[model samples]
Target: MANNIFEKSITDSLINRVNQLTPTTPNQWGKMNVAQMLAHCNVTYEMTYENKHPKPNAFVKFMLKLFAKSTVVGSKPYKKNGQTAPQFIVKDAKDFGVEKERLVQYLKKTQELGEKHFHNRESHSFGRLTKEEWSAMFHKHLEHHLRQFGV
Candidate 1:
């Protein structure tokens, strides 16, 4: 089984990884600075919790479902300097502390909600996903970015 957000210990370990990040930390790969990377990571949670970004049109969603779903929800770690979805691109600078705090809060919230709450939840682009898929999506993303900045 995958490392799941429903498990408090897993969530705690994720939180610890985020806490290890500092403002001046340099990226080992990618164009985004640490702060921008944090903000980019938060985009996923924002898509779930906030209505800031418009949902993809049906065709685009279908395309995402067909092509991007496995890359996201599967166990494979993202490649260094991998292409980001348009919505996730953080162009401007970000406050490291602010983004970090927001991500940690989001992680806590997801963990508190538990896996059952997210089971078969409809994703903005990928449609409904099992709890395992959700966990893989969330955990793999954070772990990828955290490792990118050497956190």
Candidate 2:
């Protein structure tokens, strides 16, 4: 089974991995620097908690649900250097300290909200999802990127 992001232990473990990183940490694959990667990861939470990105139109949302939902919320790991969603592409430099703190806070907020808050939650892109789907999506993406930076 996948790690549950709603669990404090798992959330702490993920934060520890984030704490292990430094600004100069090298990626084993992919184009993003450590700070950029951190910012990119934060985009997921931004979509959930903030009104930063525009919600997709009906057709695009439908397509995302049909095609991308499984790959995103499923247990399988992401491929290295895979295509990133447009909203997640971080092109400019980000402050390492700022991005790291934001990521940690987002993780903590998610954990504090707990599984009940996320059960049948409507995702910004993938529409409604169960707690397990939300957990898998959050855990998998963080793990994949942390592994990318060799943390």
Candidate 3:
């Protein structure tokens, strides 16, 4: 089973992994620099908590549910150097400090909100998800990226 992001212990563990990264941390693979990777990771939380990205049209949402939802929220880990969503591609430079702080804050907020807050919540992309699906989506992505930086 995957770690539950809504639990403080798991959240703290993830935070500690984030804290292990520095501005110049080298990636084990992939193109993103440390800061860009952090910013890319922030996109997930931004979709959830903020209206930064436009919601997909009904057809797109349906396709996402059919094809991407399981891969995203399933216990299986993501392969490295996989195709990234357009919105998640961080091409421009980003401030390392700002992006890192934003990610940490988002993780803390998610944990504080607890599992009940996320149960059957309408995800920005995947429509309604159970608490477990939400936790897997949050935890698996962070875990994959943190591992990418060798944290």
Alpha-carbon local distance difference test for all models: 0.92, 0.96, 0.95
> Any runs in candidate 3 off by more than 4 Å, and if so which?
none
Superposed Cα RMSD, model 3: 0.7
Q: What's the candidate order when arranged by decreasing TM-score?
A: 2, 3, 1
Q: Name every residue pair that clashes in candidate 2.
A: none
Candidate RMSDs in order: 0.7, 0.6, 0.7
List ranges where model 2 is wrong by over 4 Å.
Answer: none
Which tens-of-lDDT digit does each residue in 49-136 have in candidate 3?
9998999999999999999999999988999999878999998999999999999999999999999999999999999999999999
Cα lDDT tens digits, model 2, 68-133, are 999999988999989878999999989999999999999999999999999998999999999999
Minimal lDDT window, size 10, model 3: 1-10
lDDT of 2: 0.96
Task: Flag the better candidate by lDDT, 2 or 3.
Answer: 2
Order the numbered candidates by lDDT, best leading: 2, 3, 1
